[model samples]
Target: MSNQQPGWFPDPSDAKKMRWWDGNEWAVHVSRDGAVWEEPLVAKTIGLKRRSRWVWVLLALGLLVAVALLSPLVALVALVVLVTGIVGISKGSGTWLRLKSRRTAIGVTAGAALVFLMAGSVSAAMVPGETGAPTAVETAQSAEARSEATPRRTSTPTPTPVTTSREEVVTEVIPFERSTVEDANIARGETTISVSGQDGERTITYVVTVVDGVETGRELKSDVETVAPVTEVTTVGTYDAPPEPAPPAEPTCDSNYADACVPIASDVDCAWGSGNGPAYFDGVAKVVGRDIYGLDRDGDGLACER
Candidate 1:
């Protein structure tokens, strides 16, 4: 679940021991001494438990065979070791086991395996032959014969030395970094620099290591920022929406009289010359609906003929 690799990790179920994280899922294998295995004591309802039980049975049979063949003292020690290993496997399912890196767990497992092999070898040596034990002379002759039967390996040739030139680095003061501050009152999608930024100069010395005319490593020896960087102030726009237009006013005689040019009660002259007069009225009293306020008393269509 975490970035931790597939290996021994502190068990979420139990704090005292480690559990195996198989990259994607938590495996049944748990360990107290870096010897991880699926728990045997778990219920058979689990598929992993059923599979792991077979492995345990095979190991038990192997130990029994070793016990039957080896001498009493050797067999007793092997049996004790085998039993201890089994007990270790059963003890708390890794309660008190600390998590170790995969590399460390691997090393520990390799060491334990080496010890097991050595114990088995000792048991084999202690095993009694069917015939009487071989005499020292016969033992020596057998060892000689075996040595002669095996072929000896020739010595390997030394590798040729490679020619390479050492790398060198030349350092000088140069510009490095600059910072910027924002101002949000400007119009959206617009940017303006308030204060210009100046990059700081740094004096650095480096050691470049090369092999076979190819650069291999570059390490800094000295770095001194001679000038401090100047921060640049910038104004960025925040207002983006367009403003709304005002609504139109209602048309009336006082507001739109110039456009209407209709004869009203305030008209003093025949033509009502204060504002622009109607252009289409004929030279006669006009009849518009039931009102006749613009009475020319003449038959012309112009209601207020001058």
Candidate 2:
């Protein structure tokens, strides 16, 4: 109301203002919100359309039913139906299926049915399908979990065979605790090799050739002759040299000519001559004289046996 008031705000008395020391000049409007409040040139309009979810839903289900009626043909028709439904219905675009209003439902359904029928009647169509695929990742994960949960036992393997031979030799010599043996001489024929040693390390490999039981000569593998607390039985006798290694018995029948009933000849081994007996070989044994004359041509027992 004062005529002498500074022209700072519309109503200087009623307005909230921050007077600042602008260093060299007075600051103008200092509020951040006061920068710009542009006028909206054009207004947006949202058309009021009814909930067309039932519309899209009905359309998708109808398509599915039609497809069931027409297997392969249903595919192209179904695809066209989906696209048409999407374009025709504005409200149900983002929905999983389509719905139509009582008003729009008739048109939507008719368009869908017409297109579906045309596509189906004209051509064979291919359909996208899912079958025989490997199980889902979750299923596989479940199987893995089951396997991990089950208790498992592992089996131990049998040991492989180990072998040792007599004709072994060594070069380096090791000294052993010298132990003396009672000098009792006995006659011997051949020799027996007795080995003695430390816990694991063989200290002696003394093979003495004894005639009967008396020592004639000796051979050593390693030098540390650990004469174990051995009760040495020196024999003045001979061992029966394995009874001269018995000879092998002669074979009664040739392995290649094996047959209980036939002599080695033709396939039948049948009666070859006018008076010859039936010559054949079965697996069973045949006695020459016992079998019928026509039965045993090869002198085997059975007659005409093949």
Model 2 Cα lDDT, one tens digit per residue, 115-198: 555444433334335445332233334544654565555579977544333433443334333232322242235443333433
TM-scores, in order shown? Answer: 0.23, 0.14
CA displacement after TM-score superposition, residue 31 of candidate 2 (Å): 29
Which residue pairs show collisions in model 1?
16-96, 186-237, 187-237, 282-301, 282-302, 283-300, 283-302, 284-300, 284-301, 284-302
CA RMSD per model (angstroms): 20.2, 45.5
| lDDT (C-alpha) at residue 147 in model 2 | 47
Q: Distance from true position, residue 216, model 1, in Å?
A: 9.5
Backbone clashes in candidate 2 total: 24
lDDT of 1 by residue, 15-71 (tens): 677877878877788888757667532333566767876875686567556545553
In TM-score terms, candidate 1 sits at 0.23
Error of 1 at 301 (Å): 24
Model 2 alpha-carbon miss at residue 131, Å: 28
